[model samples]
Target: MVTRIAKCTCGQLQITVEGEPLGVGVCHCFACQSRTGSVFAALAAFGPGYRVTGRATDYVRTGDQGAKFRFRFCPVCGTNLFHTEEGEDNRSVGVAVGAFADPDFPPPRDSVYDCRRHRWVQLPEGITVYDKDPE
Candidate 1:
C-alpha cells in the first residue's frame, strides 16, 4: 500500500492517507486563491482510508454553487490542511498538495475555474480544463 502524509507547517496537524488519491485538481477561483494566498490552489482528493492527527480549527464556506465546504486548518501553524463538503458522510477529503511537500507527487489532472486563471499561468499539457466546477 502506498502511503502519503500531509502536514501543517508546524507539524501540529497531519493526515496519513493510504494508496493513491481519487483525483488531483487545481482551482483558480477567487475563493481558492484567497484561501491559499496564491494565484491557484492545487489539491488532491482522497477516499475515507485516511487518518488525521492533532488539533485543528474549522471554517465553513459556501461555494459558488451554494454547496458548503468545511476547511480545517492547524490552529498553531494556520495551515489549511484539508477540506470536505459539508453534510456528506465519508466523502472524499480535499488535501492541499503543498502540505505534502513532495516534489514527486502527481500533477493535477484537471483545472477548474479557468475563467479566473491568471494569464501567465500555464497548465500541464493535456489537462482537462473547466470554466467552472464540473457538475
Candidate 2:
C-alpha cells in the first residue's frame, strides 16, 4: 500500500498513484525516444483509482499499437506527465518514471520495442522483453 506522488519539473502538475502500479515498462520506440528526448521512455501504469490534478496540455498521437494515445504534459514546464490510450479505461493512467523522482518507485517490469533499443543500453537480466508491445 505505497502511495507515490509524481510531479512535473515545475511542480505545477501532480499525479497521486494509490497503492502499486499495475505494470511498469520501458519503450524504446522512436516516438517514445523523441518524446522523452532520451534513448527510451520509462512508464509506470497506475490502476483506475489513481488521481491527477493540475493544468496540462495534451495532443493525440497514433501509437504503433494503432491506438490513439492522448499524451498530457505540464504546460508550465513542458513535462510529460501522463497519457491514456483510446478505448482504455480513463481512470487507468501511465506516467513518466522520472516524474516520480523516487528511487524506490517500482522498476520497469519489461522492455517493449527492444528491437529499437540502443546497442549500448543494457537491461536488467530476466525482465521480459518484447520486440514490440505485448498487446
Best candidate, TM-score-wise?
1
lDDT against true structure, model 1: 0.95
Candidate 2, position 61, lDDT? 93
Per model, state how many residue pairs clash: 0, 0
- Give the alpha carbon lDDT tens digit for every residue of 1-135 in model 2: 888999999999998888888898899999999999999999998887777889999989998769899999999999998999878855688989999988877778899999999989999877899998888
lDDT (C-alpha, whole model) for all candidates: 0.95, 0.89
Candidate 1, 32-77: lDDT as tens digits: 9999999999999999978999999999999999999999999998
Q: Candidate 2: deviation at residue 109, Å?
A: 1.4
lDDT (Cα, 0-100) at 43 in candidate 2: 96
Residue runs of model 2 more than 4 Å from their true location after superposition: none
Candidate 2 to truth, TM: 0.95
Model 2 deviation from native, Cα RMSD in Å: 1.2
- lDDT score at residue 87, model 2, on the 0-100 scale: 89
